[model samples]
Target: KKVELVTQGEATELDKSLVEKITDPLTHLVRNSCDHGIEMPADRIAKGKPETGTITLVASHQGGSIVIEVRDDGRGLNREKLIKKAREKGIDAPDTMTDAEVWNLIFAPG
Candidate 1:
């Protein structure tokens, strides 16, 4: 399968220490995009998307901090799976909550 990587603000440089600190986490995020965030080739074709899924990394300086975002044009985080996992783990989330709230459950402590 083909995966397209789009990088924004590539010219923005950060402190070496900060770059080192974020490297592993950033790599993991990219891996997740390839492994889970993007659906299979067959699925993408069925959905009328190009066979190649795009993973976009955008960076911008906001105030004193640099904001780096890793995003993908793919299936995205599965809402239903997240909600089900929350329920199974006994996380206190209700269906009436907004989709964003449900999505945030992925970050909650067990």
Candidate 2:
């Protein structure tokens, strides 16, 4: 599978220190998008999507803060898989948990 990166709002400027502070975290987000968010070529084709996945990074100023967003064109988190993993890790993953809660389990420590 192939991944394409598209960046937007390149004109948005920030202080050098702020950029340095954010660089690592932003890189991590992009890497996660490529690694976890994108699907393989066969999987994408089976799902009726193009063979190549796209990850978009956008930076903009909103109110008093700068916002950076990473978006990907791929299958999103699998709820059942996440819940199963959480339970396997001994986390309390009840059937009543909301979709958002299940998704957030990805951030939980194993």
Q: Taking the tens digit of each residue's C-alpha lDDT, what string does model 2 give over 1-110?
A: 69999999999988899999989988998888888889999999999999999999998999999998989998898999999999999999999999999989989996
lDDT of the structure predicted as candidate 2:
0.92
Structure candidate 1, residue pairs in collision: none
Candidate 1: tens digits of C-alpha lDDT, residues 4-60: 999999888899999999999899889988988888888999999988899999988
Q: Give the winner by TM-score.
A: 1
lDDT of each: 0.88, 0.92
After TM-score superposition, what is the CA distance of residue 85 in candidate 2 from its true location, in Å?
Answer: 2.5
- What C-alpha lDDT, on a 0 to 100 scale, does residue 106 get in candidate 1? 67
TM, every model:
0.89, 0.86
lDDT of 1 at 92: 74
TM-score of 1: 0.89
**Candidate 2, position 104, lDDT:** 93
